[model samples]
Target: MPSKKSARLAALTVAAVCSAASTVVLTAPAHADSVRIHDIQGSTRISPYAGKQVTDVAGIVTGVRTYGSSRGFWIQDPQADDSPLTSEAIFVYTNSTPKGVAVGDAVTVSGTVQEYVPGGANTGNQSITEITKPTFTVVSSGNAVPAAKVIDAKSVPAVYSPQGDTAAGGSVNGLTLEPTKYALDYYESLEGENVQVADTRVVGATDPYSELWVTVKPWEHRNRRGGTVYGSYDSQNTGRIQIQSLGKTADFPVANVGDVLEGATSGPLDYNQFGGYTLVANRIGTLKSSGLQRETTQKQSRGELAVATYNVENLDPSDATFAEHASAIVNNLQSPDIVSLEEIQDNNGATNDGTTAADQTVQKLIDAIVAAGGPTYDWRSIDPVDKADGGEPGGNIRQVFLFNPQRVSFTDRAGGDATTAAGVTKVGGKAALTVSPGRIDPANAAFANSRKPLAGEFVFRGKTVFVIANHLNSKGGDQGLTAQFQPPARSSEVQRHAQVTALHAFVKDILDTQKNADVIALGDINDFEFSDTVKILEGDGALWSAIKSLPKSERYSYVYQGNAQTLDQILISPSIRRSCDFEYDSVHVNAEFNDQISDHDPQVLRFRP
Candidate 1:
């Protein structure tokens, strides 16, 4: 088993995948299958809530119970204490970008509620909500803030990770920060006048609170309607960034802390909220102009280069050519700005020698990137591989990644395949998780291993793209090969559907943001263009099969018993299709390259913001 820290990262990395998208609109109030609305004002809605049915909403999110992504997020109308007229909110993204948003952002969601009462906001036990989908639209748009930096808060206690104390520590770039105490594991605090921030800054309207009883933090990021929206600060929420007597707080001014040092908006930043020290700005400041720049995650990038993905067969690194493979990878393809590696295994019970898959794979990939001779890349892999129930005695499969330093910055990682981690599930697909690989009976809770997907963001030619790299149920003719016509029915299908569910959740998150979201869902989906999973994903038309831009004659990624099937694929949010440069290269698998190393091939797509 991997260390708890890595395991925590994995869960946080792939945490929010889950939902049942509502396609039908019902006039009846008894069910939330869909709600009919002809807004009194101009209305916008992405079908199935940007491809997800159940979503969390703030403002007046009613009809609370359990809902969304197997309860990874939920909604509630818990009566307030009655001192203030606090409205209800729906937690649409329990797993995706948890801390980016604040407590009071107004949003409207469409999804079912839950059977259980959630523990607290950061406990990770919101409830299981599946058939989930929702989008964020700005009834009111708030200022933007950086993602992982710290904003000094005197009264603000240290922030902590969801599982333990202090999510972030000290020093990044040129600035240093105090470790996060325990304000909220996944949320930014707005309770006091000064708000700690890093990464991105808030850009919104200003407020006029002369009496100054209204202390605040920036709002949370949420997905609403057809457009993406963030929280704002008004009388209801923090209206805008304003000035005040920020009380003296603890200072750890080495990283992006200490408010506007070196003429920057808290410069010298660290990416993770957990590892670095951060500072609170003592004086009022403008949202930093040049700390980190991401147009928006999941939104398409602006460029001519095509983006692609592949399963690389069982990307298991062996000793014989572990060095050789690394050399070849860097020499041949070099390091992709962001590449997703799947079917990766890590030691489960110390059975597989003392060496583990996670470490081995990261080292090899990083080594290869170094050999390739560009800027060496940073690699991140899931800690506790999502254990497939009863499968393989001790091998755990995980999706891993490598990032090119010169090309992009590693923004954040979310949601992965670990069962022990909080707010995670196998409801979408039913593969049971095991300490090892192979099969277990369908009855147990599974951290089913599919092609592990990685979610984060990167800037490609100034345009930011939020990417979800997936290697779905293999098209090896064995993974759900028996039920190609249906969405996986057996445990195998469960694993397949789990991948699908996760992908859908990803789509939901992307759509929840901006109008022109650049989303790419690529990898060995296992299902072809017409398969159940593919069809379901493309159903509402919110997503476009990026491969469709390529001629059908060239769509196949793998050969199944000699039949041409598109095992590898990409799906782009509709917002990015017309402007995206989507393409694929079968050259690797063609008569020219060795097609036998892995059954699947690679595909790419490009976007121009």
Candidate 2:
């Protein structure tokens, strides 16, 4: 019969990679047809004895997850084979209580072998090889559980994946695992087993879901804020892993970057659909602060312009995060002269009305900025047609600019409207925008359902600086890192590449007429600094990404899945780069917090205009 614990402990069936450990010896009946759990787990990604009937399987019950749809108990063979490439423990799926079996009970079970996916086969989730419809007899109770194996810095490999086949364009999979060399192999080696990681550091913010990520090795790819910089494939970041307290244990604590887990954390490793491989801990350690403080940019001096890009993350009047955002801008970013804001929703956010104007919303933000002791800023943007620009349905999220009138002046020409496209025009022997606040290629198909680029001219210290605020296509449809495809498809970049191409053509037009035009294209580019989209925007060094000027470890304005990465960027023309006095700061306020005002932290760039 199904026990009450079955519903909550259903998650215990999720398992991960394999590893070797000292096995415990227990007395068991010498059945002629007994099978070992390691023999069924095998050495490959799939089980060797899957879908077959095993009459007698004996092991000590290390874990009892009696609740949830995946109600089962994990059994570890006391006498295990000496193979680092195979796990010793396997989950026995009973779908209900197995009568009197409990943790530390040495039981012999008979059941049919199965490969069960948590959400079933259609979800592309990995399958856990288990014994279902089990009938188990307890030989003894109150016996000691298997010793928890320790996985420290030396235990994990520095490489991410094995080299993929040449025909598959370097996609990794279907290869023999050498756990001593590759990190993925090492984790795979310990799948479905209890293990411990001691003296680890939390590398990512504890998410709203009460889960945090930790790096077993805190010295590799370390960021300024103590997060790990997710470099390209060459910089194998092997020590990062997700941590969760299975319902069987106490709630996992919410933590930030640089927090330390004192002593040892013991748990069973699980590979699930949400995060690839996670350590679901049954025992947690004390969390300590690492003295990490939030960073602020160096103040801009006289004759210098502080330009910034912030994605307010669907900011609307109804959203209660306005005051927090205003405080971040005024206090954290130090009130940049010109700020490019993305994801600004219409007056009634998500109401789905015919209204496309955001005048009230912008005015409220300006009032909040002044209330927060910031500059009296003026804003400009050409609102998009209702429901045309992509974002939250009926929210009409678009990009806009906030410039301090005392520090800079908007160079208004004439004739800019919601649908009218802007062009580069020659005014008095200098490159000038035809319309002061206008859209760049509003009618282009590349920007369909995406925020169009808002280009505007500003005069800072008597020098004209053209700025383009953009919110390109997001990384929505891309395949996940743990996707079934070896090298998961980055199909979302195709649209972003086209969008940047259009922006590049517009900037090229201005640079063609005036070779040394001061053009600053900045916003949530939604692409990485090394991405092809940024490459197309740079176009042989015509414009350089200022974030690249920062140290490789500090070049991120966003963090996702324990990887410190960059999604917001500031790319300045050669004129700004030649000045060589540019200061770029990824003001880290929001991204690394459990109660984040927005998903993305802002980027600030200060230079002589």
Candidate 3:
């Protein structure tokens, strides 16, 4: 789903008729008394009166939104209706800031009913019922607003959504909503109506866009650090709701995970493109900080080797996060012997000037680590072709290995370049890489427009170890959990599955040559631990993800839309896992904090070879 601001900008550019003040006349006008708000809403996800004009729909103004491209006011009918399946309120889009509408004003609006789908229909998002090109007259002033319907843990069903009808192309748009059976249906039933959630926990921190996420059910899949864990696809945390403010952006609270929104947070329930259902709040609650602190992992012993993986989130030479990232590596991670860094952008980041070198970027980070009282690290990586890899254009993001020479030594072999393929061979009856810091099958179709895996050889205490670093294809084009298609399609997984298959075969080549060889593959896998991508990488017992060794509640290294999930992982071979003497920790430092240097938390693995 797209962000609300981006969706609004798209609307402003594409839909010109929405900005007109004249009445938009549709096919035929309906009788004033026959077309109630509920009658227009019907009992389905789409409005029954869409693309038709309705006259004199009476309601009281519940909230007024004067910001963004989609400026509108919500009107709710005070008169009660018996059915709980239809909404009593509707948004009257005024195109610009509404002039004479107040929160307590009673108005009768006459306009064309439109089903506005944010981010367009191809995104599979549920459409929002709105009365566009509206003309309204105030009937009364200073009237009481309708009572807000409370939404809590008991009201939301455990089941996330219903299976879409096969006849309708796997869309639940035409089916009648069952508010009691499914959580998505329950939210659809209250669309455009005034709602409230009391004393909720902040699961996602306040992002740069001034929006945060909260969960009504505080205890559902709650982690030790007060986050809702998304263990699997079947267990979607249905209590999550995105919150945006109608007030000024400066007035929005700055909150971290585990904080509390004390008192009543009341607003009109809206469906947007970013997160499925959102609360466009007129009255936000007071923030109570929980004092959630960053976590630090125990340092590795003299006999043990510590290796870590961290995605710096597109680090460049000009980024201000260098010092903070250095502190995180030295203090929080306890200075791992070998670190696999992902998204290390070129020196001229995102400039598209055909520059493909990242020596300046890497050297700046090494300097920062030394300034932070850490080891003097040596680095090795192959520069990618300009604009060939995916990510910000001209960034040429690739994986790099940073090793502390005092504790470990890198074996450098020549003849590795951007387009060459690395192979495995045997040296002294031990598995060895032909070209150290060489790419694995760089020209394969599976790695097209994506980062290729980098393989390196390291020696720790006279023991040889093979490390493969990867940043797989991202989950950019997949459908959301609240998509109209039930069991939403993961189209992005096709390329990821192919990439992991190639990776699995490469790992097998080494293990087949030497059955007991020690290998550690780590980085941002960009898929869940239980996903097919991970399973393919672990094919035929060639490797195993170390994240599964920890308890279920402590497996996540990323927080997305209030669901604590896993996108980064470290996998070990039979030589490491079979010994059963390794420790894995997903350090929780950045993902849960408001002042974050990166969106992903680092993962550390410690073991003696």
The model with the greatest lDDT is 3
lDDT of 2: 0.80
Q: Which window of ten consecutive residues has the lowest lDDT sum in model 1? A: 37-46
Which lDDT tens digits does candidate 3 get at residues 563-598? 999999999999999999999999999999888999
Model 2: per-residue Cα lDDT over 468-534, one tens digit each: 9999999977655654345566888988989988999999999987989999999999888988889
| Residue-wise C-alpha lDDT for candidate 1, range 118-158, written one tens digit per residue | 22212222121222333333232242222222343343343
| RMSD from true fold, candidate 3 | 5.8
What's each prediction's TM-score?
Answer: 0.41, 0.87, 0.95
Local distance difference test scores for all models: 0.37, 0.80, 0.90
Candidate 1 accuracy as lDDT: 0.37
Sort every candidate by TM-score, greatest first. Answer: 3, 2, 1
Residue pairs with backbone atoms closer than 3 Å in model 3 (clashes): none
Clashes of each: 139, 22, 0
Q: Name model 3 segments beyond 4 Å from true.
A: 1-34
Candidate 2 weakest lDDT stretch, 10 residues: 17-26
